[model samples]
Target: MYIHSTDVNRTLQSAISNLIGMYYNSTAAKPGIDYPEIPEWPHGYVPIPLHTVIRKTDFVRLLTFVLNAYELKKKNVAGKLMFPC
Candidate 1:
């Protein structure tokens, strides 16, 4: 499967988690079963490659962020950004 994300670290990690959930094969998790023999590899762990464009070239994402910041500034809301767990 092909996986792609924004160059941002959070997006990269989120893509990796999705790949693990979607593609890992438990039946072939053992050494010499589906890949090179590596004792250290975790069971059912598949190395999935993530593709991303450089930040400067990721125009769509950059534009969205810039627009959001501009809107926030226009609103003039004085508050720290927050997320609830």
Candidate 2:
């Protein structure tokens, strides 16, 4: 899935926007947990930037999901979604 910077940025922004809007009508301006340079992270925590989080394999997986989402013959498989061949 080799996602570029723009796609990653868009995804992050959209996810953050949705999360922020979940319980409040107002939005706050702040950097998210995606920023990994911050010190004193939570215990047993290892932070990675959002752009790096979604790797090539993840992109491929997401592509499969996207394709599967539109598959007419798709069926539930152990609570998992699959694409039709």
Candidate 3:
């Protein structure tokens, strides 16, 4: 998978805001955090999971897990093709 780390901060802020909105109120007052509006996708919606096991509560960590899984799958495919003796 093509993972882009661009705008990691902005993306993280947006994700937190959306989570807060979904859990609490749209205009909920969450101190010690910046609540920015999430970017809209042009086509079909991309879903974000509400619950996470990793308690970092940020986008980069979550995205890293997803990207790593994709990379691992790609590597596995390459390994299988090369060792098909």
TM-score of 2: 0.30
Off by over 4 Å in 3: 1-56, 78-85
Residue pairs with backbone overlap in model 2: none
- Tens-digit lDDT string for candidate 1 (1-85): 6666898889888988888888889786766655566778676676877889998898768888888877776676665653222
RMSD of every candidate to native, in Å, equals: 6.8, 12.2, 12.4
Model 2: residues >4 Å from true position, as ranges?
1-7, 25-52, 59-61, 65-85
Between the candidate structures 2 and 3, which one is better when assessed by TM-score? 2
User: What digit string (tens of lDDT, one per residue) describes model 3 on residues 1-85?
Assistant: 1222334567656765665455554344333343433455212233344333334565767677778777776788646543211
Clashes of 3: 0
Highest lDDT model number:
1
Model 1: what TM-score?
Answer: 0.62
Q: What's the lDDT of the predicted structure labeled candidate 2?
A: 0.46
The CA lDDT at 57 in model 2 is 60
Model 2: per-residue Cα lDDT over 1-85, one tens digit each: 1323334666667655554455232123223443333455433232223343445466655776678676644456464654544
Q: TM-score per candidate, in order?
A: 0.62, 0.30, 0.25
State which candidate, 1 or 3, has the greater lDDT: 1
